[model samples]
Target: MRFKIGIIFIFLCQIAQAQQSEMTVNQNHYDSEFKANSELISEFENNGKSNAEFRLIAKSNDNGKISVYIQNNTSDTISLSHQDYSIYILQEAMNKNGLWKPIEYWESSDCGNSFGEIKIEPNEIIQTKSTKYSGNFKTKIRFKLSENNKVYYSNSIVGNINPNKLILPNDFSFTWPLAIMENIGKKTPLELQKKVVFLEPNGMEEFNEFFEKSMNKKN
Candidate 1:
């Protein structure tokens, strides 16, 4: 019995060692491929020693819409706040009245309040539907990351808010910044712009009625 147990332990050790060796080899290959990839337009490292890396790239599809892909480029796993992905109007992008507020948006899969861990192994990519803004709106994204029960923030991206083309076959209803949309309609200042959140048509009627009434009271 002792001999059999010893043999089993040795076999388990061999399997673990093989896995670690394979992971090391794959990591080296990923580093090389990442350096050679030309599609990567920009990259960002975590402000601190946190081993999280981010990459941004854009591509045009057959439908004539541009798809902006955000990539994770580190060996360590990252936990992201899935719900607080907002389209923040940069300080330079704010106007005199401060009409633009950070528009809160959520994906269908990310609608619930949950802490999701993003484990994009080296050389892997993840995709999500970005906020569809209109006009010349410059913007950035703000969210939270978790490490050892402590939360850290990614830096505010400084760049143009690429207009993601969202087309509807019918008259889609949307609610933008009330101070901006109710007052200025679509005429924004030359510098500052608006981000509209297109509500799904399923509960459009009820939501619009309730939301408009609530805003009227607040105003």
Candidate 2:
């Protein structure tokens, strides 16, 4: 009986040690990611474009698609790259809690040769492209565009169609890094992809704060 108890105790000890090791590895992964995200956020704050005069607007056309337009109120020409102009922009939904979450609009490989630029001359109001929202989610939805290494958001419109059902859980939240990472596989810029962080559970407030601070454009 004494020998059997000794073996059981050793087995338990091994199991405990293994679990502890796994947890340590997970924690280390999270720590590394957090540190990397901090660095990326700092870099973006220093270099990301902040043209308050630029206006991004979205309106439902007579057709089923939403037409997006970029009004260049800036004095300089704006160059928007990543070729499929409007396809990869994120379709964001406002949850019941008033927090925003992204519902992906396009699904395609980003490893393409779509590095071409589309220039909008000064004082030009150009139509970038249109997106068809085919989902069943009815909420206040908006478009988030990352073009020319700068981020711009559109005015909110009602969204009742969410085809892919890509909506996040009610408890889920939004962060710029998380939103950018979710769209990384879908033709997002390589520079932004390299700086993305995993989805944060409660970063909605922080995300809005960052947007407000960086681009305070009125809709």
Which portions of model 1 show Cα errors greater than 4 Å? 1-37, 41-68, 77-101, 105-118, 135-219
Q: Write the per-residue lDDT of candidate 1 for residues 1-219, one digit (tens) a residue.
A: 999999999999987554322211000001112232333422333323444465444333344333344455576654323323321111112322543322322222223443344445554554433322224445543322223333333344433332321111121122233443554434432122221222222332444455566567668
Q: What TM-score does prediction 1 earn?
A: 0.29
All candidates' lDDT scores? 0.35, 0.48
Give me the runs in candidate 2 sitting further than 4 Å from their true place. Answer: 1-53, 85-88, 105-112, 134-136, 163-219
The superposed Cα distance between candidate 1 and the true structure at residue 142, in angstroms, equals 8.1
TM-score of 2: 0.49
Candidate 2 local lDDT, 96-157, one digit each (tens): 68886655422322445643565667755555445445434578878766543355687799
Provide TM-scores for the models.
Answer: 0.29, 0.49
Give the C-alpha miss distance for residue 113 in model 1, angstroms.
Answer: 11
